[model samples]
Target chain A: MENTTKDYSHIKGWGIDADPKNDPTYPMKRRTNEEHLGYSWERPTLQPQTVEILHSNERPNVTAVFGTSTPPSGLSGMIRRLAFKKTENDYGHWLPLILADRINVVEGIIEDLRSGHVPNIFAEKGYKAEWKYNRGGLLRKAAVAAILSYGVVAYFRAKKKRKHNY
Target chain B: MLAMNYRGPLRVRASQKPMPKIEHPQDAIVRVTRSCICGSDLHLYNGSVPDTRVGMTFGHEFTGIVEEVGSEVTKIKVGDHVLVPFNIACGQCAFCKQELYGNCHESNPQATAVGGIFGYSHTAGGYNGGQAEYARVPYANVGPTIIPEGMDPDDAVLLTDVVPTGYQAAEMGGIQKGDTVVVFGAGPVGIMAAKCSWLFGAGRVIIIDQVDYRLEFARNYAQCEAYNFNEIGDPVLFLKKETDWMGADVCIDAVGAEAAGNAMQTITGRKLLLQAGSATAVHWAINSVKKGGIISIVGVYGPTDNLIPIGNVLNKGLTIRANQASVKRLLPRLIEHVQNGVLNPKGLITHRIPLEEVSDAYRIFSEKLDNCIKPILISPSAGL
Candidate 1:
């Protein structure tokens, strides 16, 4: 219960808040989120694009991280939004909404897959490959960053060790 | 009432000195019941005000009670609670009739934005400012607002400058129905512009800033989406992705050259490209807006070559409307919204202080303390 419930409630997708910063678990609730109705700020919503992610935790099983026009829905989607907010030290003004939007997209993909809504549901060979490619890309980036960090650390460590010897 | 006393760059110890008054039949005496510092007011403190003089009242953001009427004044009654929009226009003037109060021909027709501004130098009219107990307002019947019964002065006070400036940013930007709008800067005016965009039916309103504290406060309070311009290397690229590869339907230049850094010299010391820096804003506007979209400016500027790509806005078929908001025209509607609770305009006031503490208010607000968006000033203990 590390408060995994995301608070990315500011995101708007598919005609609703669709995200969790508005989720009740967090305090400092933004009272005006709903009050504004945001009539004047509305823009044509983006057509949800579908993508899949094979996020791994401790297991090697597929999480069915389907992508949709909007992000995934529910608390999990809120978590992703919060992750983006985390990037901006104190969370961005639109982080919640953006996070929520990403969540809605994921949720739509998942829902379509579950309901046989996506035409090439299982046979779409590209889905699995895309997921794997995304995972691989992320792994490669992380590995490069880790190697760079270690290289710098090792360089400093070796220099300090040699300085003592000298 | 006395002459329009101002806080000139030259420090005057005459805090007790009387202001000058006008006896023209067209003039009316207004006891300023409410007044607040404007971003332009800092021009004086910052030594940017041109041809400075003494006894000038520096505030342009004000609401007041009509204390006395001139012989020719007929529309406004004494004791009327009115929010004075900054631009002075004679209603009968050709431009005023067309609602172009900034270019009103009857009064100081040469006055920029239709006529003279209170406390501004000879560039506009040398009319006194509103930062005192009393000010003589010209064409009082035309500009003074009658606060409806039971309306809160704080809610309507901004009708003069900040509120309209904010609304004008949204309006003149030509916000399309369900168009995505983004505003750069989250200052009081920026936040109001974001809020007003929503009020104008924007599908999504985004605000960009590097101040984390301000982003947090605005997102939490104003319900706006915030972007970190500092973290985002290419704001335009990121914004395009955020809006499906279409830039903002409208972009507002709330942060003029000063905020953008010294790379962009300030046209004058006035904040962001209000009317003065329209050209500076024009450059960013052309880039931030989608082709055929509009970019509006509300920040103040002084005369200079804007260095804007004039052909771009025209080539893109982008509409550009830059003007100092005619407070007399926009305040009443803003007031009605406040009175009817259609919107909570008061929420914009992030801090409140007593009249004597106004100096502190100026310090904090100017320094942008604690996510200070807008601070309202009340008298010695007017129960603010």
Candidate 2:
């Protein structure tokens, strides 16, 4: 595989300390011949990659040990692939990735509902702690949620009443 | 084995747990001698970080004596005194090869960003930390460095996280000679960042925080100007005035999600969980930095979208470099600094509590009681 290293040399002082001599703390950091002692051992055997792994586009190959817990799938997976296409610095990359996470949470809830288990969102979201420690904040949030929900229901009910009068 | 147990937010207790054993070929079991409750741990304790399950241990900065090693572990040996870097990196990964140990691809491959970190919740990989009698260290060959001969264990424990993090915060700033650096937050990392800024030839260093004792500590320890942001009213404007309206050359956000100054940020980010912890310091940093100046963030924010002014970042042409400190990369030079007496890693410790009273340790640190700058937990089994 070809090494596709990104050139960030356009940025001023980029990789300035790539040469150790340029480091401002060079006076204090004397070179000890033993710097490599701990790092010189044989590499460990690679864990086999059995799951669908999503890696940054900049990398040439998958890492030796990749996580297999959650593979890219559904809408969030597609968004993640799109996210990986852009460099990390771009807002385009991060915003979509965050959106993907939010979508994944909703997907998880739907999946839980599909199965026999009824997800206890209150317990799962750590609301018990919120009620215990931050009762005022939790109450304020509940009040706001209640008002908004009531307004929506009232609006639709008034619309139905108006049609009947016509 | 006695370990810190996570009951819930603002809740931790000392509980008996089974002694850790080598789970992988590259693992090592260390009997923890010293472990520090990090500012980041408070994020877990405060319920700021997601996926921080109940019954999980929370600690990342630790030093210990190796008690056991896996079959494949060669560099580290049993009975060796060592300090473990918070990052868990397989030595051969592409990122690790480039000395970007914090972003090691293999360690936390489930996440799109950041590698595995011990006891940093499931978001950082579910590796139990060293706030116990024993800890299981994976990729042991790459992460654990033997503490140098005669190095104080207190200093050695800090080297695992705080020293390297603060040093890296300045390094990432790419500070030039005589540049003015303004650090936000006067916590250990912020104080260390201010102190290390001088090593990078910073002409002036100013640290900002709301806490009186911490500001005083920063003023004395870092030998830099320090101010209470609450007293200053507008931190960005004060920084601008201090720099003669030119703003600072570099601004660092050592305070992550739970910043307190901004009411709106506190309400939305901390109180409501609208966005990852408050980006208040980040907002201040971006606004106070000179156009084209650098902003280095070593603060631990949740892995989510933050409300920040990207328009200013682009218009000001500010350079932002942020990450979990690549501890392995910075360890050697930091160890040298400690040896030369240039950086006093142990002097940061103001509170030392036994591992059994881990709950009180968290409460004191969390509430900022006793003018605590740093706190270390002494394991009962240490030196046994």
Model number with the top DockQ: 2
Residue-pair clashes, model 2: 2
What docking grade applies to model 1?
incorrect
Report the C-alpha displacement of residue B59, candidate 1, in angstroms. Answer: 1.1
Interface RMSD of 2: 7.6
Q: Which parts of model 2 have CA positions greater than 4 angstroms off?
A: A1-43, A46-166
Error in Å for residue B303 of model 1: 2.6
Stretches of model 1 off by over 4 angstroms after superposition: A1-166, B1-14, B20-22, B52-54, B109-114, B261-282, B354-359, B379-384
Q: Tell me the TM-score of each prediction against the true structure.
A: 0.63, 0.75
Candidate 1: Cα lDDT at B134: 69
Among these predictions, the greatest lDDT belongs to: 2
Taken over the whole model, the C-alpha lDDT of each candidate is: 0.57, 0.80
Query: How does candidate 2 fare on TM-score?
Result: 0.75
Compose the digit string of candidate 2's lDDT tens values, residues B239-306: 89999999999999999987889888889888877778898999999999999999999988886668
